[model samples]
Target: MQIKADSVEEYLANVPEERKEAFAKLRKTIVENLPSGFQECLSYGMVGYVIPKSIYPDGYHCDPSLPLPFMSIASQKNFVALYHSGIYADPDLLKWWQQEYPKHVKTKLDMGKSCVRFKNVKHIPYELIAELCEKMTPEDFINIYETNLQKK
Candidate 1:
């Protein structure tokens, strides 16, 4: 389900009650573990962590008016989704996460290029998510992002 909210609080307020606590804890894990320089905000209708314009003035390439999005947490119809751009942009990081997921979560990894879907909120691996959040800084993301952009 897509939540159209103006702010993170509004978004959380709108999340289905079934997923609220898990979603909130996931958001907290990210917020507390993410290295300094990323800002929290509502982005693309989800609770997002981004590199503010003050940190990366150019902003996101697709929409320069917005900040550079690094991660997002959303409550979907059947799952809670955690989207991390670092894992998508960096092969080594992606490999690291894939290898690490099973150690923390017994269920098969349910993931897309960047989105990790947790159909069972109780099984969401908060600790692994926290480590993932710490894996990249804003500057590191910008470098990987730009390098990938240049290849396009």
Candidate 2:
């Protein structure tokens, strides 16, 4: 569920009161763990961590006008979502998460290739999310994105 917001602050303000705390904590964790050179902004109606055009002139392959997305967080109608592009691009990361998340989260792990959905705030694995954020620096993500693009 994307909420139209001009900035990260605006995005947070727009989030429902019920989800505020969780979102704030998750946002904090992401910001703290994010590698240098990644900027936080509103992208696709969510809080997005991106590689700015100043560092990666190519921007996103799908949309040159937009910065290259590293990760994103959003409060959905039913759950809060964490999207990590690095985990989606790397099979090893995905596999590791699949194996490790269950040990940490009491609830069933509801996840896709990159998006981890949490129906309850308590179910969110903050440490794992931080690890994912730390694992991919802007330069690494850009290189991976380019390498994948070439294969297509």
Candidate 3:
């Protein structure tokens, strides 16, 4: 169900053609709005745009060497998922977004410990998501995602 591949090419191949069209659209949305310093990458078995590991050294998650990721996206067996770590490290932002994101997204965010899942790409507000993505830089994201790691 979940996308699992070693490379971006491999990942895209796993998705059904219908999902591929949707994924391509979503991928373009992310890329068009991507801020400088951050680059398009395939992480966590999906098409994700996160701070390169070179900057954060941990890629997605708080743990530097762990498999955990800060943010990711995937075209799954049943639905599409857009994982955001921005609010994961910033509770205030999380709460704000929890209330604000729905206004545009118009779907219940399938929340996990930190990820958000949606059954279809149409349900997600890629524009709003794109805004949030654009607002933060890789260094900014790394700083936020790793904030708790520095706590005493």
> What is each predicted model's overall lDDT from 0 to 1?
0.93, 0.88, 0.69
Winner by TM-score: 1
TM-score attained by model 3 = 0.80
lDDT by residue (30-108, candidate 3, tens digit) is 7777677665667756776656556655543434564335467787667777777776778776887788776886567
Q: Which lDDT tens digits does candidate 1 get at residues 1-152?
A: 79889988899899998888888898889989999999999999889999999999999999999999999988888888999999999999999999999999999999999999999999999999988888898999999999999999
Per-residue lDDT of model 2, residues 40-119, tens digit only: 88888888888999999988989999899889999888999999998899888788888989888888889888899999
Better of 1 and 3 by TM-score: 1
Query: What residue pairs clash in candidate 1, if any at all?
Result: none
Q: Which pairs, if any, clash in model 2?
A: none
Candidates' TM-scores? Answer: 0.98, 0.95, 0.80
Q: Give the Å error, residue 100, model 3.
A: 1.8
List CA RMSD, all candidates. 0.7, 1.1, 2.8
lDDT of 1 at 29: 93
Evaluation by lDDT, superior candidate among 1 and 2: 1
